[model samples]
Target: MKNFRREGNSNPVPAPSGGVVAGDGVLVGSLFGIAAIDAAEGESVEIASVGVFEMKKTSAQAWTVGAKVYWDGTNKVATTTASGNSLIGVAVGAAANPSATGLVRLNGVSI
Candidate 1:
């Protein structure tokens, strides 16, 4: 048991363009998830794959619980529109209308 080590739930990765902040949605290769803390360019930081986060969303539309959500990397907003977007997670709360952000339950699933 001396060599045993606890595995972490998060992984460190390079930041994307413009750098990444805590609570920011980051997409690395086929892995799309959230930043656990603020990280500058080229810096290693923890990225959580599964958690409930208040993410940016298309404020113009409403959301329902359990509805599939996609991460619009270009706009950095979560939307119900699924055409050529990465699957981030599901909406745990409802967004009545266009607003600042919405709640998303990140399950760490790929598109």
Candidate 2:
């Protein structure tokens, strides 16, 4: 227990350029998490690294339960496409096409 630290389900990380709003999904290095509150760029922001969250998804793409979800940082949305996206978690529920949000269980690790 000598090297123990606080539970990592949430941690403080610098906000990316352009800042982030509360509830926004952010990628710090290879870690993906949801912003716990609004923070300016370069400021330390608390991010929830693991949890079931209702996240923004590609409105045009439908999602099935258990499908791998990736974070499209550029678009600030959750996506099923793996190319150029960071693996964040899995879909916990089916999502219909044109839906703006989807339920996701954050895996906390980028891979």
TM values, all candidates? 0.86, 0.97
- Among all candidates shown, the one with the greatest TM-score: 2
Q: Which residue runs does candidate 2 get wrong by more than 4 Å?
A: none
RMSD of 1: 2.2
TM-score of 2: 0.97
lDDT of 2 at 82: 99
Provide the clashing-pair count of each candidate structure: 1, 0
Relative to the unseen true structure, what is the C-alpha lDDT of residue 11 in candidate 2, on a scale of 0 to 100? 88
lDDT at 66, model 2: 98
List model 1 lDDT by residue over 1-111, tens digit each: 898565544667788878898988888886777888888887776788787889889989799999999989889889888988888889999888867788998867558
For residues 23-53, what per-residue lDDT tens digits would candidate 2 score against the true structure? 9998999888999999999999999989999
Candidate with top lDDT is 2
